[model samples]
Target: MDTPFEIFLSAPPGLEPLLLQEVTEAGFAAPEVAQGGVTIQGDWPDIWRANLTLRGASRVLVRFAQFRAFHLAQLDKRATKLDWGAVLPAGAECRVDVTCRNSKIYHDRAARARVAGAIESFGGKVSPEGSLRIMVRIEDDLVTFSMDTSGELLHRRGYKEATGKAPLRETLAALFLRQAGYAGDVPVVDPMCGSGTFVIEAARWAAGMAPGAERSFGFEALPSFDADAFAAMKAEAATRRDTDLRFYGSDRDDGAIRGAEANAARGHVADLCQFTRAAVSDLPRPEGRPGLVMVNPPYGARIGNRKLLFGLYGAFGAVLQERFHGWRLGMVTSDGGLAKATGLKLSAGPPVAFGGLTVKLYQAQL
Candidate 1:
């Protein structure tokens, strides 16, 4: 086993570069990006820093060990042979979430049962709240075990009490903002800002606040988790301030505005942002400044009325063309046909995947 160990930080698809940049900036050397994650070598502080500072990552995982097993009995024997106490403390809440891609152990229940039984033998009970979420991949006859250091997904910033029909993940919202090259000086306006994730994330970034400052991570529950060290890290982080940050957002639904307001208040960014009820067509652009107009509109999933949303997009596009000049646009859409309804010219090209969902993050020059 490596001393400081190598950990993989999972990210939304096509966002490996974003996460890679975060790792590099956090003092990790030359992070290698993969399809859904980036691997870096580090000790406990690196893991803590990644949890606290990485704005684009979804979960931090430690690749503990790997073993070969041909059958279910061999799997159980191999699992019990490895050391689990190193990651999880005695009688800690532990659970295994396995994903078998192109593997012979295709049965999920049996896998879960085997892992659960093995873990239980060591007096650790399975719970919904598992600090250690072990992901096992059994391909051909090879098996790999990885432990999740990030307990709750980082997107659950502990602020969003009320969510919209199609809520955007907070990590994703921040990544999209960074991808747009936002430096917190330019105004960020989300017209269809359901639940205010984009605005709140922007406010946090602008304020120089730690993304996981107010929240807790699964690693906190580990035996290696040091409260004073984490607290000192947080206190050190709270010293920086971005007083000039300008963040703003709006939504047509009255309930969504209320929810956004409530959520932003909890995140301590309510005062930093402006929220109100206004249809995307009537969204007023700020005067005399080049800002970002990013939108995560309804994608016709549930309560997805495409015909009605088309007009909404047209109005938004018209506003972009007529009133908003020099404003950069970042629109997230799952449907290519629906994105065309807006009719914004593609200045920055190509759409990317987010949350295993292939959504195009397009930019338009207006």
Candidate 2:
């Protein structure tokens, strides 16, 4: 058996535990949660599966090599000695990003230059805008090298070309769903759905669809990538299970509803998700046992005036309380006062940094 490589699964700072749970449930062995991410050991096929299947990870990185370098000369010498061909093909375009802290090689630009020069000497073209990234971190006199196996952020999903103002990311939506105790067996409804991220993600998860099934990964360009093995893995992951439950999303904006429908179609979950245009005042519970009513409503940080949003949230809460009995609510908002204005008995989770603002998930059992 080949030796397992160190894989780091990056998530938003506050979402590490959720991501760790996802990694562990996805069958990655003994994942350890670290600051801002989760660490696991896996072979190259596991790397492909991690990118293909894990929904909460922002990116996946492979810690390919590490060494101690006392100076720039030592760094250059040690970098060149590594087998570049094992990961990067000769003449492949790559980018070197370096960060230095508490180390003799303190100049970030200089460190990047040395690593770039070493890669160039090994017949790799250094391009700052390249998709393939080699990240170098110098901490406490030790230099560590990691390759960004996920080229684009995993949330892109190669779908959702159209979105409403301040749409939620798929990764964050997945984490919030998990935090709210959604396990794909029950139906989900997003009342203030912007572009159907929550509904579509729930549908996909319920159907056992791989989040990256329609996307390409950065590791495909690496020299060590196996096309046949990856294809088999992807084929196996693409086998979807039947879902009796339907996911629902509603928005007042017709454009947003149209975009959500298109996005759901693109994500191959349109059959399982229903997107409609309806205001909070007119939102109705779908026909089923109520599961989770998750919504990322407009807040002062991204959309409408904070003062005006209070009425919107209050109306939302009123509608849910009046109609949807025996349901759970998970709402994302940056303002505690606004969440309280809903008049629901909601418990706020830890604040999560999102889109340059601190937000929390306000959950309640209705």
In terms of lDDT, which candidate is strongest?
2
**Candidate 1 TM-score to native:** 0.88
- Model 2 stretches with alpha carbons more than 4 Å out: none
What's the C-alpha lDDT at position 303 in model 1? Answer: 52
lDDT of 1 by residue, 1-366 (tens): 454777889887777788787677768854899879799888877888888878888998877778877668888987887777776788977767866656778886788788788788877888767656777777776787887887789988777788887688888888788777775667789998888989988888788777887778878887778899988987876554857656778887899999989988887777788898987777787755788988888777555687887877777888889888888998888877777888877544345665446777877877
- Which portions of model 1 show Cα errors greater than 4 Å? 70-78, 99-118, 127-131, 238-240, 347-357
Which lDDT value does model 1 have at 325?
85
- Candidate 2 backbone collisions, by pair: none
- Give candidate 2's whole-model lDDT: 0.91
TM-score of each: 0.88, 0.98
